[model samples]
Target chain A: MLYELWILAISSLVAATCGIVGTFLVLRRIAMVADAISHTVLLGIVGAFLVSQTLEGPLMLIGAAVVGLATTYFIQVLDNAGVPADAAIGVVFTSLFSVGVILVSLYARDVHLDVDHVLMGDISFAPFHTIEWNGIPMGPQAFWVILAVFIIDLALILLLYKEFKITSFDPALAAALGIPVTLIHYLLMTMVSITAVASFDAVGAILVVALLIVPPATAYLLTEKLSRMIIVSALTGVAAAVTGYYTAKYFNVSIAGCIASAAGALFLIAFLFSPSQGILLRGRQRKKAAAPASS
Target chain B: MQEWLQFLSSPNLQWVMAGAALLGLASGVVGSFVLLRKESLVGDAMAHAALPGICLGFLVFGRETLALMGGAALTGLLAVYAIRAVHSQSKIKQDAAIGIVLSVFFGFGIVLLTMITNGSYSQSSGIDEFIFGQAASLVGADVQILIASALVLLILSFLFFKELKLLIFDPLFAGGIGLPIRFLNALLSSMVVLVVITGIQTVGVILMAALLITPAVTARYWTDRLGVMAVLSGLIGGLSGAVGALLSSTISGLPTGPVIVVTATAFFLISFLFAPQRGILFRMMETRKNTQFVLNNFLLDTMYEKLEKRYAAGQYSALFSRRELEEQTRLPRNGLEKTIQALQKQGLLTQTDGKYVLTGTGLAYAYDSSLLRRIQDIHLTHEAELGSWKEASANGDLRKPRDYLMNERIHSLLTAEQKLPVSLAIKQSSIEYADQA
Candidate 1:
């Protein structure tokens, strides 16, 4: 039971990191990039496994970053060369992801890199593979790695506080002020790629893609500042992960789907009931304001 | 390639191609308004939000087919109405509103999918495919449904094009002209919902949204005229759908959605590079020519200055060695030498014994009054140039909007209540322009 709690904590922390980075990605209208990166990482993972003859953490990260950066570079190149933003994204991400799918089939058949794990992740069964550290049980390989990543991301985001704010708000203005807008965008893309690949092992590919965008976007509804948005998104991500986990167990369904659905459901509730902005509440407020004027 | 092309030319592939073409044409036509209004992602939300409708239809009939589509379209229309109403009554931004509706509605869909999968439903596995399409699985009935939907959409678009254009181009003028912007918005959103529902089978909900936006965006590079843009967008989309279907069928293990999207991107790349006025190749060539011309004139001026200094020194020599000229003028060896040779042949300079000197005409051209005019013609960002009237802010101040517009010269063009915001409040304001603008 205690071990199960540790697993939950480990899972939540991993989700929180994705949520944190995804906030700015969605705000920058690059939500699709996050989607593209998550999908493209499969190719990277497969490629790394084929080359390195092992699935070590750093090798996967390097492979994923290379593919992810290539995805971003190719996309910007397409757009710069004349492709529409949406179409360029679709083209570059799709092509790379297709290559990834092909590679997965050709190699790594022995590994559990099958469609099911690719879709929903293997967290429920992740606890079975435990490692011992300092003669104490470390539940899964994902636990320590995810926790470290979460802390690193939290610190890095805090460190670059002002620069992220300016760039996310208005990149053109930031550029005019000589804020190294290109470098910042690339850094953000790199961070998105790292977080995406990390979360992929815990929450499956598509669910991670959906969660990264959905939770952060939901947080944006409740806050104006980027700082507040990051905090709110992390909270929403952790909440959604826990709710999704237990609910999936209770109902005996896909945990990734439940987590994604829970995040979506939370946003819906926020949509209907959020003060000042929610659909129903805003309609009522509009009426209340109009009543005095009509009289 | 031959075998692939042969497979592509088959009757089944042809049907799928035809359906995709018609669907593409409809989206391009409808999506023109969506993009122009910068409400593009409204399609994304509508697609996600339509899932519950399919489930409801499934719940009613216990299967997945055309009926589920109608149910989804209806629910999609409802979601659009909700989006419109929320924006109208509240201060929530469009993107946030889209995100909210998209997530919540999709949340409901997940819950429904769970129930349906848990129960006895053959369509469960196939239905998930609607989130990521399989173009190969397109059957005759599906093609007919798509064609019918496309026709219906086309007819509605034609009936409402003028009104839709008016609303998108100028909402206030449209309202003042009594074109019913609200109803027109609903009409367009309904059209969007209809297109998305039909597209789900071929491109899934997520990728369907991409198809809706991608072709239209690609079309934008080809033409600025709304009508032409819509037509081009349709052709690109149709070609993408066909080519994507072909590519996926030929390849052993390619997903249809990604293939279609990649094909659409190919069209975009072609348009971006080859389209007249906007192509990067044309722009680069034009810029290079302008730069070379500037370099040429600067070379001529430097030559004339050397002549003037020599003339001041009472020297009559019309020739100087390459070594002396190289010291006199700082330019790269090969290109400069080539330009000098070219200029000498053009009578702008005289090359005698590998030395070049300015001609009488070249000397006059160096001090020509029209040089500034020629430079100005090629000056990019001339408006923002240094020492311009705008930079110094010391001109007639015609740049100021209030001084120019409401300063009695255009008073006769306005009615009594027209200039209220300008004079009474003295407010500096602008409508938050859409992202497309």
Candidate 2:
């Protein structure tokens, strides 16, 4: 029982890792794009499989991440060249997914990726498919890969500190400084893709989207600073994952559904009560802003 | 062809096609303005929100028949009105309001559905197709409803054309001019709801948004004029519906709605590539043409004037060095070098005299259309007006409404004692309006 709980703990940590990266994604209003990336990563999976016969963790992660980044980069590049962001996203992802579907049909007799499996994770089955090195369990590959990606995200933030801030906050100013705003966009997008694909094995594709978006969005409702938002989102995500997993176990219901619902609940809490960015709360703020001062 | 003819003539398929065409035409016409308003995806949310309406309808009527469907449609219209109310009365954003309405309404619908299933009323149909989209279930009455709805929307749109344009493009100006912008705004939102409900029997919600958006977006690439955009969008949409209907009939397992969406996407790709003004092929050809003209002039005036010699790289290279070349004269450096290389390939200029002499073909291309430059600029600005309009609208500027509206209001309300003008002028977002896009 303790071991099962530990496994759940590791899974939540992975969720937290996804949430940390997701904060910026929601902040830049690229949450739907994150959803599109999750749907479109099948192309990268097929590409990876064509190159390497196995679904060995690192190979799949890198392949998916690269494709994810490329997708985001092209979308932004087209948007910059006068295409609206949503239209560009719609164009790129649907076209790529069509190609992916064609390839998936042409290459394999039976499609390996199940849509149901992609929508929801099977935690009971997750424990069975384990890998180890010599003596240590290395926890689960889901946990470690997400952690490594999280670390890489932190490193990228550290190195390109000023550029990410400027680009995310004010692209015009960033462009004025001659910082390759486009390059930073691609870099951040690549990280998003990597994080998406990394935890994908544990929590299917669509739920990964729900995870990536909901926590960061909830965090957005709570705070403003980059670092603080990241931390808050991660913590919130981890808490939700734990509560959600146990709730699923208790109810004998859908793990993904529970997690998504819990994250949605967190969003509602913030929506109802958050000081500045909440929906109803923001209306109050607006009313206050518009009010004349008392003498 | 015979089988397809028979199929097209068949009543069921006829119902499907009519449903598709009506939904397509209405969405095309209404969606053009919706896309212009950037409320494209609000349809998608309303589609989902219509679930509670469906559930409620089913609850009252005891099935998924026409009356229940009407109830669902009413719910969708009300949701759209609510969206307008929230956006107008409050500071909630369009997208966020959509998200809020989508989840809450859908969540309630789900709960209602769960309760219905729990009770004796589990005989619901069309819910499956309602989530994605199902174009196969349209019967005769459904077809009639779609056609009537489309006709109503078209009639209303024509009657309210000038008012709709003003409200969509310059709400502030319309408001200032004492035109019931709120009523017109509600009217447009209601039209979108009408489009979605008409679509529910055909496209459903998830892909319905794409249908509403994609044709309008594709049409946007082709024309600056809103009327042309509306007509073109309707054409694209109708064609896609026809194709989707035909293809889905041929294929056994394919769903009607997705196939229709895919077909629309095909039209979009075609527009992106083949549209005369903003297309990929046109842009590329224009760029090539511009370069060729400058090269031809450079060859005729610069290299050709020099001597009867195979021009060498060094001498005519001066013609290539200038950064800004006139449209008819010497080309810019990059284009000049490319042309010189082509000329060299044709044995015209290859370091024979240290100058780039144009090939006869290259020179001919340059001289072929000296007047093309002015033509090209006209196309470029006109081709991308959607972005320009979006930016301009976001800029919130108005140049010609204060006098017209204020005086109209003063005259109408004070002198005429018009209650409508005073009541209509009670909006805060109406700061001003600029000229047309």
Candidate 3:
């Protein structure tokens, strides 16, 4: 039972961090870049592990952050060089991910890093890898990693709230006001990279994309204000994390997959039933508009 | 080399290679249209969306390849439509809608896959290979399906070549000319779906978009003509596919899908750096040459002006020391020497007693100011015309006067309450403006 709670706490923390960072991603219309970063960060982790010979080192996060920034930088370079944005993203991330997969298969075959686990993380076993200090158990290692990432993300968002807002909303105006728009953009991508790496072991790389994009998108539908969107998205992420955990336990399926599915389900609910932007509400509004004309 | 020949001679390897090549050709052809339409990632969304369809086909119709392909095609088309519908109906933009549909459909597919694996389906064990693709597992019948589908896609694309080109380059113009644009769009989208479905088995759903867009983008660097780009893209795709297959066969445990994608990326990198006109090397060369030309022109014109000033002051000899020339041109010492050497080689300058003097040819070239003045006059007139046109358009002076009367009539037809609020807001704002004045 305690194990179950730790899993829930880790998953919720991962989801919430993804939600907070993903709010800006969605607003900036680069949510797909988050998808790209999640995929390529695998290369960074595998490379880091190969060099450091340890999975529990800080090098993994640093390497993943570097690769993540490299992905964004390459995508930008390609875009500036006349390749379309989507094609650039498609090319860079797919190639990096392929390199990572090949590396895992070739060099790291004896290591714990398998392609399957990279694709679909095993959250159930996360609690067994506990973190200890001074011979006292703190919590699951995954939990602490995500807790640190969550705090960093929260602090960054708070400290740079105004810069992030202006840069995301209108980069040109922000640039005119000397806000270092490009620096802010890279900083956001760096945070995304860190969040993706922290959540990767728990949710896997592919589903981490789902965690990063889905809840924030659902929150976007539910609210009009950015602050409310952030809060709602974080809440939605936590709710999905808890519900998906229980659902997966009941069904004996993959926990990360279930959490992603639950996030999608929440998005569907918001899509269909959100009071202001819901499909049903729009349909009713259309019907009401046509009623007077019909008479 | 002998081992490679033996491996190539194997019938199963040949079949896999053939299937991969054909898949590449079809996707490359369809991908050109996708790239031109700026819908490159739509292929990715469709690929992810096809997962549930694959599972559904397995659950309902067993593990027949044709049944699975049909199911995947159906869902792929559904996903495209869903993306369109979501963005069109809601406030969601296209990218967000794509993200939504991709994750949701993929997540749902995972759910179905897990359910099937847990259920009593004996053939469900190897279905997970579809996630990363296991081209080695493809049998003879699968090869035949790939060949037939690829051929059909190629034939259909060739038949509608002009129409596709028009749709890609200028859809609004195509619509203006009374073409069946909506049908053409639907046809092209379905063709993309067809290519994606056929290619997914060899490259997997995750990397199928790479096979679709990479070769096409790489080919774009080598040519400007669409026809040439399409053929080159297809050839590059086919080559990457064959190479990837051969390498995967030679190496143990290297997945064919990622190998193929990496091979295509390799091709892209080579083209990006090495192609003649559009490649990075050539672009850099062109920029260097342009900068050299500008610098040379500025230096020569500066020398000419300085000589002219001396001539106007009654000094006929257009001679100046290297230091004086450098001061006049503001060029660094080495640059001044190089420019003077280049000018001397071109018979535009001469060195007499350590002083640079303009030759007759250089003097004549410098005196040719009429060409520059004419170019400046044309530019000035063009700017004036543009300015007048913008003012005229802004003031509505070029519009039909009757259009304004019609607009005013429509405005008057609104209810008094409707007009009152708008007029009141205008009045309030104008009153504030008056107070500020």
Candidate that would win on TM-score: 3
Clash totals, every prediction:
0, 12, 0
Give the clashing pairs for model 1.
none
Docking category of candidate 1: acceptable
lDDT of 3 by residue, A59-178 (tens): 999999999999999999889888999899899988999999888888888988987787778888899988789999897888989899999999999999999989988999999999
lDDT of 3 at B73: 89
Model 2 residue B156 CA deviation in Å: 3.4
Candidate 1 residue lDDT tens string, B1-437 = 99867876788877767666666777767776677777766787788777778888888876757678878997788778766754564544555455546555665565576677777766566666666666767778888888888889888877877787788888999999778777887788888988999887777776666677778877888788887877777777778877777667666666666677767767766876777778878888889778767767777756555644554476544456787767766777876777676677678776544555555565545544133332333232343532353432345443343443443534444334433222211111111011112
What is the per-residue lDDT of model 3 for residues B218-271, given as tens digits with 9 covering 90 to 100?
Answer: 999988878888888899889888889888888897888889889999999998
1 against 2, candidate with superior TM-score:
1
Q: Which candidate, 1 or 3, would have the higher lDDT against the true structure?
A: 3
Q: Least lDDT summed over 10 consecutive residues: which range in candidate 2 chain B?
A: B428-437
TM-scores of the models, in the order given: 0.79, 0.70, 0.89
Better of 2 and 3 by lDDT: 3
Q: Mark the 10 consecutive residues where model 2 chain A has the least summed lDDT.
A: A114-123
TM-score of 2: 0.70
Kindly list the per-residue Cα lDDT of model 2 for residues B209-319, writing each as its tens digit: 766777888889989988898988888888778788777777665667767777888888788778887887898899888877556555544433232122222222222
Error of 3 at B123 (Å): 1.5
Per-residue C-alpha lDDT of model 2 across residues A1-295, encoded as one tens digit per residue: 7557655766686677778767667666676677668757867877887788666667888788878987887677656645566666655665455455445545642555543344344555665565688987755556666668878987888788778878888999999999997788778788878877776666666567667776776677677788788888888888777876787677555555566557767766876678775567778887787786541
User: What value does the lDDT take at residue A113 in candidate 2?
Assistant: 57
